[model samples]
Target: MIDRFLDRLAALVEPTILALVIILLAWIVLRLTRATIQRAVARALQSERLSAREEAARVRTLTTLAESAVRLTVILLALLTILSIYGVPIGPLLASAGVVGLALGLGAQTLIRDVIAGIFIVLEDQYHVGDVIHVNNVSGSVEALTLRYTALRTLEGAYVIVPNGEIRIVQNLSRDWARAIIDVPLVPEEDVDRIIDILRPLLAALPSDPELGPLVLEPGEVFGVESIGQQQATIRIAVKTRPREQWRVARELRRRILYALREAGISAPYPRTVMIFHPSSPQPPASS
Candidate 1:
């Protein structure tokens, strides 16, 4: 009994040690792979003329995907190695895995499609985590992204999850630069030329503002008389601004313009209705 127990213990020791070694090696490989992926992505994007923030986002995105793939592969390889060390036949296991993978692929078509789409999205750099985009008629800022889905935060503080496979015709609003177009509606009786004159100086001085100067790429332009309706005439003003600055600039400009118009004694147009009542003398007399 003692001799038999010793033999069994001796047999188990070698495999156990080998398994631990394999696990350690896998950990080292995972770390190295992650670091390498990061370096490679950073080097690849260096020539793209992107801003530091943009480049860092792209590098982080690419490295995360690459590292995940490498980690999964290493874990599988390590697991197989440990199994084989214990006299487990890996050939049959591999064959069974292939069959199971085929079944899963058929049943999880949507998952596979999403992953493929995600790969393309990352490769193409469609958008990054801070980018405001409109996808499938839902507009929001990207909060997180993964192989299966993307997370967005709407302006109203709603959280949305979108499967990557369903993304089509992405409208990226936070790319490069944006334009703020403001239309000021005035009473039709107001002088158009005079309104333009009033607006021109205010628009020109926007870039000189200390708070808004850095965000303003170019001085605003007043496009006179966009349209003329019965009640009002629309005067258009457009200003070029940095990415994501359009809305802020537009709001501030509108506020200032409103105050300026008020100070100048110019009031905005309002809907007016004239009602005419016809006298029904014969019908009233008949009723009485």
Candidate 2:
């Protein structure tokens, strides 16, 4: 009877110690992973090549995403190892998990797709928070991003939630730089050369303006006479600016163009109307 009891205790003891060792190793690995991730992010952000704002935004976003992925993988692997050490049949467990996964996949395909898309988006560096993007016909600045969805804030202050899978096309307006393109329409009869000459000085001076100097990266370019319609001629001016600065720069540039045109006495095209009034026929009938 004592021999049987001793044998039973020994078996219990071996499994318990093995389980404890597995847990301890998992804990150590998790701790080291966290520390390594933190150090990598810190080092990246501290690099002197990027501006403070750029480093902060980019590092913070990518770091959060990377840590999330790593933690999930570590936890899952640790769970599986612990189960195997406890003599749980991994094959049967995996089979059951597969069945459950299939059911979840059928029911939650959209969710799974979103997660996969988000991972790709992050890995590819498609865009990040604070970047202005147009997706699914909704144009907004990315306010937040996660593995499931992205939150955007439009110019009108409306918040939009977009699932990663639903985004078929992404137009990222704020990446490394942005462009401000403005079309100025004038009467077709106006001299295109005169307009271009008038715009040259004004556009050229944009980069020198203290307020716009930093924002404007590329020198202004005027594409003269973009199109000449019957009534109007369009002159296109495009300028490069810092990311997300194009909107303000474009708006201000348009305002300046309008003011310059008015000062120069340049008139825009207007629809013409011709009226023909016939009173002679009525007067002749009355006399008769």
Candidate 3:
């Protein structure tokens, strides 16, 4: 009985241990690759002349994506290795998988499309995680971008998950520089061209302001009167700013312009108050 047990152990134990070793080695390699990928990403991010927060965020995003891909490959390799150890012919197995994949493709074409689209999106750098984009009619900031889906958080604090394939057009608001636009209302009594001229010099001098130098990319521009109203006309001022700085620039520009207007004694149009008299009122009506 002892001899028989020893023979059985020799036949199975050695190969099982060898297979375990191979799997461990594969895992080690996977970890190394993950580390290397992460380091490369970090280096690339650091070399960029971006803000500290942006650099860190970009590195984090690249690392997460790389890790996710590596993990998926490891899982697939492990499964294939196990199948090989069980004497499954890999060639036949792969051929059968191809057929099965074709069937799945027909059934879930949208899923495949989404995955492909997602790959292009990441590769092209159309938008990244934490970017604010307008996809189709939906506008949100990206929380996460995966191969199959994208996670977004709207301005209203609502979270949305959309399949990548469904995004027909993407308007990335956080790409390079954003525009800060403010419409100032002035009474029709004021000259539009004169108001523009007054603002142009002030706008040109924006880049010279030390406190606001970093946030603004260039000077602002008066885009002309966007609309004319009964009470007042609206003149639009557009200021270009670094990504994510548009809102802040808009607020600051508005404040500065308001102060300038006040200092120049340029008054805004106040709401017109009209008094109405009824037929029964005692007030006499002006007549010829």
Better of 2 and 3 by TM-score: 3
Q: Which is superior by lDDT, 1 or 2?
A: 1
TM-score of 2: 0.72
Q: List TM-score per model, in order.
A: 0.88, 0.72, 0.77
Candidate 3 residue pairs that clash: none
RMSD of each: 2.8, 5.5, 5.0
Q: Sorted on lDDT, highest at the top, how do the candidates line up?
A: 1, 2, 3
Question: How well is each residue in 1-288 modelled by candidate 2, as lDDT tens digits?
Answer: 999999989988888888788778877887888778777976966754766666667776777777778878877887888778768889998999999999999999999999999989887878887778999989998888888999999989999999999988999998778899999999888888888888888879988898788899977899877888777879999999998899899988888888888898997778766579977654455554
Per-residue CA lDDT of candidate 3, range 1-288, in tens? 999999988867876876788789878988898889878987876766877656766766677778888888887888788668756778898899999999999999899999999888877777778788888678888899888888899989989998999988899887777988899889988988878877898889889888777888998888998999888899999989888888888888888888888787899899997689868758687798
**Which 10-residue window of candidate 1 scores lowest in summed lDDT?**
279-288
Q: Is candidate 1 or candidate 3 better by TM-score?
A: 1
In model 2, the clashing pairs are none
| Top lDDT prediction, candidate number | 1
Best by TM-score: 1
Please give the lDDT score at residue 29 for candidate 2. 84
